[model samples]
Target: MPSDTLNQFLNDNLNELKEQGLYNEIDVVEGANGPRIQIDGRDLVNLSSNNYLGLATDERLKEVAKDAVDSHGVGAGAVRTINGTLDLHVQLENKIAEFKGTEAAIAYQSGFNCNMAAISAVMDKNDAILSDALNHASIIDGCRLSKAKIIPFEHSDMDDLRQKAKEAKESGQYNKIMIITDGVFSMDGDVAKLPEIVEIAKEFDLITYVDDAHGSGVLGKGAGTVKHFGLQNEIDFQMGTLSKAIGVVGGYVAGKQNLIDWLKVRSRPFLFSTSLTPADVSATTKAIDLLMESTELQDRMWENGDYLKKGLKELGFDIGNSETPITPCIIGDEKTTQQFSKRLNEEGVYAKSIVFPTVPKGTGRVRNMPTAAHTKEMLDEALTIYEKVGKEMNII
Candidate 1:
């Protein structure tokens, strides 16, 4: 049995969440999360996964992963600082550096962990972090863990960032200042105004960091947003994930040799946690090699994105200002948005509703992720269902 105090706290919080309509009931996908997913034995047109390039279920990656497991086993045995650093891990890091156009790179268990490790490794009590208002939760937690003064600028507002940066620098209170933002804002699919942000960083002598989790496999011909703007040398930290686009499970921080050296020594997760398995390392290396070899998958992903966007627009759905493949059909009220998603699932589509806290209140939306693996037939079916449901809900 749980402790009385803990039980009571959990119950109260859960009840409050339910009453506020904020409880999220997770769905169980029975098979691989691909262009089509199975739930309760029913296959649905999958538009909810972050498998942007469809490499998660790629045969080549699977073959390499299996071969690695046979050669190196399933686990890295100890913490990275101890005996866990394998040859495959070193090779993977080198591949990441080459892929991102950085001098050196370091990998973490997850993108969230990378943020936690990298932020606290450098910035601390005497520092300040000027973060975007709508940055990912991991970024928020990372900044807090640094024990630094955090000032949030309005989302994608360059003027606000510039003003905040100026104020923070002129105050002379912090020993160091950093500006952090997502390379691609996941919720709205908007690209960050990195050029302007870089200009501000230069003016204030601020350290620049961009979390390219969503942009790594989808932008700049699969190189990412830093490369998209040709500002590879300007950004201090280029953080990315292997999970979403690479169809694997890990994250990385790529930068100069000095920064990578600092992180290797100071990053808590790198020092304390076990390194990635040999299979993950080898498969990730293969994924990077594939990305470097061709732009076929990235190009297909964009084409699919454009096709879906045009279909949704023609069906009279409002997809907010998105610059990437992520599509969000705005449906103001939380309950209605939830109902719309429910109907979509019933009609054989798998898009999910995102509401309050994940997004602003009263701006609930159904987020759609179109991957390179999705067929035109699958998209056509999804659009047909969407049109039917929209009209039925009087949304279109």
Candidate 2:
């Protein structure tokens, strides 16, 4: 049997989370995650997915992935350094470099692993990192893993960042300093002030890293946030994921050739973990090709996002300031937020509640992600459901 102390700790914490409505009860999706999904034998409008471009179910990518499976088999048999690096992997990395307008790029198994590998590989105990307070959990974990002096600045506050950067540089206690931020904050959908951040980094001689996981294929005509601000040449690291915008399952870091070379040899995940499978690599390459071919999907996504935001705003619900397609309906109370999401699900909408630890306490919300695949009819139906639920609960 497991230790009683461990069992007690688990029981106590689980009970506390359940009582406060903080315990997440994950619902199983019956099919591909798209604009609509099935759960418990019922179909619901899905506004909780990160499939912004709707390419996850694209026929072109599917066909390519199938071809890759036939040609290259199911898996990359070994770690990248130990021969798992196939021709498909090289092709994907090249395509990523082309898409990101970087000298070179390296792919990873996941966005979280990319952060974990990249940050710790470069920065160390002797270094300092000026991180945004609202950065993702992955970025926080990465910084912690680096064992760097992490000084968090206020979110999007350039002055705060400048002060922190100046202090870190002037302290002369660190061998190196890096400024890391999410190009687009996923929670509230606010874009980072990259231009200002770049200016500060330059003044302080700090390395710049932009995790554009949410911004890729959604901004800068699909090149990403660095290109969105025309800072491709200025930013040192342009990190992104193939999973979200590209509608595939991988992550990557795009930078100068030297940086890519270093990460190839030094990044733990790339060195020790198996490379991406043929299907994922090929599918991701196709997705990037589609993104670069035209901006039709990206444009439609913005239109749908604007339409949804306008509808939510007109209904008098406190949809927070979201610059992107991610819309958050603030409910204030944690249990109320969870209840609101449950009602949304019951009424055929599948948005999820995000509460404490994700966002600050007292700001619990139901995050609605309107993808490009959602037709106007779907949006209208979702809005109608929102209206009914909002009025019933007096949320409006």
Candidate 3:
């Protein structure tokens, strides 16, 4: 029995979303979301996962995870502050610090929680956050939780950031000012101008926060966007994830020892949530070790990306400006974008359409993430399906 007010609120919003074609119907993947996947009894080439390095299915990670299960059983019993912090957790944090070239690092349950914990823990009512307009939803929520004045600068617009940062700094309205941005804009897949951002931060005495969720294991030879730009020491907070490239699940913040120390004690998620399970932590450590050992997987990922992007372009698709392996075929209308994705699925490719709310209206696209696991043959096959679908949908 629900209240009339509650029912009305739900019905109104549901109707609005449904009318706008924004109500998403999720499709379940029957197996791993590899280069090829199974959904609804059909085999489709998956182009939507963030597993750039393809380590998610690597034998080494499996070995590590199994070994962890044998040694440590399953879950962490309590929050990290109580009995959840195992030796594996410490080792994983240390491995992260080594991988990120930082003095220390702290792990979180998820990359989303990293933002939720880090931002609110440091910046408060007296502080202000200068955020990039196209930053992730986690970043937006984090800023709100901090109770700080969130000033949005145009995407990658350093000039505007400088102007606003100066205004915020001089107003005497805030005690601390922080400039936060995604290391790689996920929608556009463009790398952030970290060198210019660091300069601006220095000029304004602003704390720098870089959430490198997409950049880790993709850029900087798998270190991250900061290291890719050779500004590791300049950036105050370097946030990364174990889920994407690492092929595991978790996030980390690496920086000076004092920052890590403060976050460990104060970051809300770290203080309240259970630490990562033994298997996840173990597999993540193996992933980092593999990344550090060689760039073979990274090279393969880029090779596949280039091959796929070239084929998409040749097929008369409008692949957007993406410097990374990420490819987006721009389709102008939301309905058309959804149709394109449905056609792709029917034709055996699994690239999903991204429409409004994720990007501006009329900027609908089918975003593809090509990974190291894809072979030349697989990509060519997928490209052929894309071409067939494009012709059928008259998208090209």
In terms of lDDT, the best-performing candidate is: 1
List the candidate 1 regions with Cα displacement exceeding 4 Å: none
Candidate 3 — what's its lDDT? 0.92
Q: Give TM per candidate.
A: 0.99, 0.99, 0.98
Candidate order by lDDT, decreasing, is: 1, 2, 3
Q: Which of candidates 1 and 2 is the stronger one according to lDDT? A: 1
Question: Model 1 has how many clashing residue pairs?
Answer: 0
Q: Which stretches of candidate 3 lie over 4 Å from their true place?
A: none
Candidate 2 per-residue lDDT over residues 1-396, each given as its tens digit: 899999999999999999998999989999999999999999999999999999999999999999999999999999999889999999999999998899999999999998999999999999999999999999999999999999999999999999999899998999999999999999999999999998899899999999999999999999989999999899999999999989989999999999999999899999888888999999999999999999999999999999999999999989888999989999999999999999999999999999989999999999999999999999999999999999999999
Model 2 scores a TM of 0.99
Q: Is candidate 1 or candidate 2 better by TM-score?
A: 2
**Where is model 2 more than 4 Å wrong at Cα?**
none
Cα error of candidate 3 at position 255, Å:
0.6
Model 3 weakest lDDT span, ten residues long = 16-25
